[model samples]
Target: MKIFNCAQFVRNLSIPTLKFYVAQHQLCPDLMIDWSQPEKNIPKALFSDIRRLEAVQADELTSLEKKQSITLGLVRWQDDLKRTFCMANDSAINEFRHALACDPEATVVFGAGSPEDIALWVLVYREKVFRDAELHLAFQAKTHGKYWKQHLIPKGLDITHDQARLDKFCEEVAQIYQKVGAGKSSHVEVTERAQDGSVQVTIYVEGPLTVIAHFEKNQFNRLSTRIALETALVYHPSNGIVESVVKGGAKNHTAVLELFGKHIVGQEITPDVVEKKEFRLNALRDEMLEPVLDWSKHGVHKVRLRRAKFTPVGRAGVSFQIDVPPDMDKPDAMEEAKENLRVRHYFDAEYAMESATLIVYMSPAQDGKAEHFSFGIQRLGASTIKNLSSKNQAIAYEVLKALDIIDVLDGPGNPVAEEQPESVS
Candidate 1:
């Protein structure tokens, strides 16, 4: 049959089709784990014997792709491999959620196989959930015509006797009536009516996964259309590397929307709303930057912050002046100095939390390159230090006060002193 209104049909089928693919890769052979369970259902398995099952699947998936099934020998080998891996790493897996948070994308936690192997699958499955939603939306937008006639329309087109006739009508309409003048056609009212009646839906699964979309007419349900629509998403393949995380404005919404096309054109948030989002984002930034402040003493050289500006990306940024010893980078200079020369540090900033942190990155030269640093700051709240018996709020307060000083200095410094300082104080 000629393709008439495929967009609507594709969107309708998006969820089920994508779920089928995830089930193939995710579901246990005995169906002990239900891939359809949403995020909230995952807390129990956070400490379950999930690794053994994952390892078995990994081995079986590899062998099955090659030979199509686990033969008797393969089964025996798989069980033996599971026994060995489980014996070695079962307890460690349950204890190490934050152990690999340093490199969340590439970091591995314990599983039936290597933590690396399990992390690889985790990232993959998460993306599968996203991509499935995305493709559905794209398909729906592409084939909305088919959906309009077959599903959205009150009296659906008759397809049993004259499929060709219906297809031809849809093709002609899609091509000839693709663009309509405002208020020129009666169908616009009907289309708008369908959209208004449609329900916006979202499904969030634990393990850092979420699906958002809508149910329109009968067939098309776009899952998590907003984030999936604009962001460039990719599921990691085995041994794949994710270097950095990008938080785009499109996917990162200030508030949730119930319907897909209900665009917030002129809506403005109250000052209080803006402050809330900023406060939370800052809190998260502080949490992410906490590790850097663990060590107090500098190893060899000290870094001085001269100037800094908050980048549009909203992370810690700086224009630093470093103290470099003479002859440090000379051809015959000792190897260690070369490695420790560069500067990298991060400081966390939180408005509500009375505490923050400064992290210093010390990357000494390995073979022949100059070293670099990475630094950030994070603010603490009731939650971050709720469990610790004794916590330090001094550093956070001091750093924030210092930041105020920097802001003042950078804003309206002494133009009279532009001549330059006479000597280092």
Candidate 2:
């Protein structure tokens, strides 16, 4: 038997919200007290101190005070929950209670330590509760099929056809903006436009700037999209094509073209082809001009640059990674890369082993936290400087200087400064 734990159900429910459930279900709850009427339900003898909440601000109350109030208030809820569930219909009540437990609303209430937290919690709780209610209705529809699909489903009016309703709704929306000091709205237009076997919605806004926006048809449904994809590959992994679109512009045209040619040229673009294709292989490479020059300028020709990728590291920084088969596939690749990369690699093989292959990260130093750049620069020196030779160290230092992580000395004989950390990274 699936035992219904009614005591557990009412433990964290908002009392005022519970009233909606009670009235809707026709429940005769006894001990539970609503948030608004805490005094009405609880006895005068019980929670005498909590009853003084009327004089004190709930949001400003101390932690101990809130704990005392909630602890006493829960006592009443425990008694009421048992009584309410005992009288309520077994199946329906249990389902609703299960939904409440599963919802994020109750989870947030327990997680909240203060009134400010509870305020945000309530907003989240209410949103999730509405969604949970919709889910419950869906469950009800499975058993009550015919009635659920017909009578229970109220027909909604089309916005374009119902001018009066649309006007009234727009007026209310405008009033809401005015009431909240969001300024007045001019008007709302909902006209449909047909172009190239596709429907485009025209939303005309007569406001401060008279702005207009558009939403295109779903790609698969549009004629132009279909025609453009006519020679598209036999649905091999679409990641490359998708990535090309994401990257955009003329720069990625060759990669996009090659990717499509490799995948599509002679193959099908059906659903089954898409399902059968594998996307485990590496993405097509693009040799960037900037990093190629950086490598040439570095003058470290021993470790041949196999492939290079420069990715945006943080808000305002770039991470340049170069893969050298010689640097990686060696028996002591890590040791070799580290020793050759940093001037200090000879003194610390462990540092070389840790920093090798990861290369350098060029991140913007936070204001007043530029001091930490020394540590990051030290890490790069461990991983980035390939050789202790005069020319090689100069090249590595040049790269580090450009990133603003370290200062460049006038000559190669000048020693690099020691690092310091003052704040959290």
Candidate 3:
């Protein structure tokens, strides 16, 4: 039995959004409350229903009811938006109750039993109405993370919205997941496809986990630990561009590309092309790095170059990483950093910049609460934009493209050069 602070959760949500979610989900059909006038009576009615449900002890629930509850819990927990909404609502309601209890004049409403315990269960009912809902906009408002971009060459395959072709692609993805030790259960589905033939695919893998110890109800307990991993990819066949937001590491990313090549393209991507892409940013690092440091013109403030990594020409094994302190704003810092590397014979000719990490501060919805977005750019046509809203992500991408940081594509015209040994100075 999990305990939730039901009162706190309800208080935090905008009344309109809560009303919308409740109405959309039909959470309390029996209450028969008028949703049109939610501000006047909906919150009170919702609390009463939660209290009644919570009064029913776990032991009193029938076997079928218990099973249903577990199933519903698992489903809601897996979704990003529903889980967030429930947690937020629960926290807000609990806080509200606490405030009321502390106030001498305000009477605390002690309905019955522990209503907080069943709050989440009540909100996330058995029905699967929200599975296809547009809750991403709401979820994005609450959380943030990094998104990585990559490019893929479709070769012979013609990208389309054909159902049979998409099903075949999903089958190949499942096979690839098995080969990569991802899991035996894998689901691949097309989430969206644009008019230009670019497709957004989502891959989910489930695997069993081993835990040494578990604790529940203040007693020793053992529970099944099955975890699910998700990866999102958008492939543009027109230009052979693929952008991925992966949930795991390099192996998972490699598995996705391998699936796309072997199944869709009908040809395996060569090791050289698969491993390295044509990234011209190294050659234009000096010209681009400075301009990006001052992004006030793009509506982003306090943009700073935090770190830069450089690999020596003809010496792939040797590299230099310079960390720029926040207070250090010297224009010659990069040059001086390279000069220091020359003394150690690590700077051959000119240091070819490989990657850089930049930190930018911006506010979402102009709410005055600025979030620190730290993003990294690799010369190998990969860039990571982190902790940004959807609008800010577009702005960041535009800024990077305008500066030629991520313009190079993975294609045949730009072949990877063989490495050579550096001559002794």
Best by TM-score: 3
lDDT (C-alpha, whole model) for all candidates: 0.26, 0.30, 0.48
Q: For candidate 2, lDDT tens digit of each residue in 18-75? A: 4444343311222233445563443332234334432332445557755556545444
- For each candidate, C-alpha RMSD in Å? 22.0, 25.4, 12.4
Model 2 — which ten-residue stretch has the worst lDDT? 227-236
How well is each residue in 1-425 modelled by candidate 3, as lDDT tens digits?
A: 23434454565445654555556542334334566664756677766764454343234554766546644543442353335444333333342334234443223222321333223323344122222111222222222234343545643355445666656666666565555455666666553222234455666666545454677536897776656556666565565556555545565567767766666555776322234443455533451254433455566654555677777676466777777655434433355465566645444355777766666655344566666565566665444442243345555665554445544242122212110011100
Q: How many clashing residue pairs appear in each of the predictions shown? A: 28, 7, 10
Q: Write down the TM-score for model 2.
A: 0.16
lDDT of 2 at 67: 50
Worst 10 residues of 1 by lDDT: 187-196
Per-residue lDDT, model 2, residue 332, is 32
Measured by lDDT, the strongest candidate is 3
Error (Å) of candidate 1 at residue 84 is 24
**Candidate 1 lDDT over residue span 156-226, tens digit each:** 11112233432332233223222321111111000010111222122221112246565643456756421
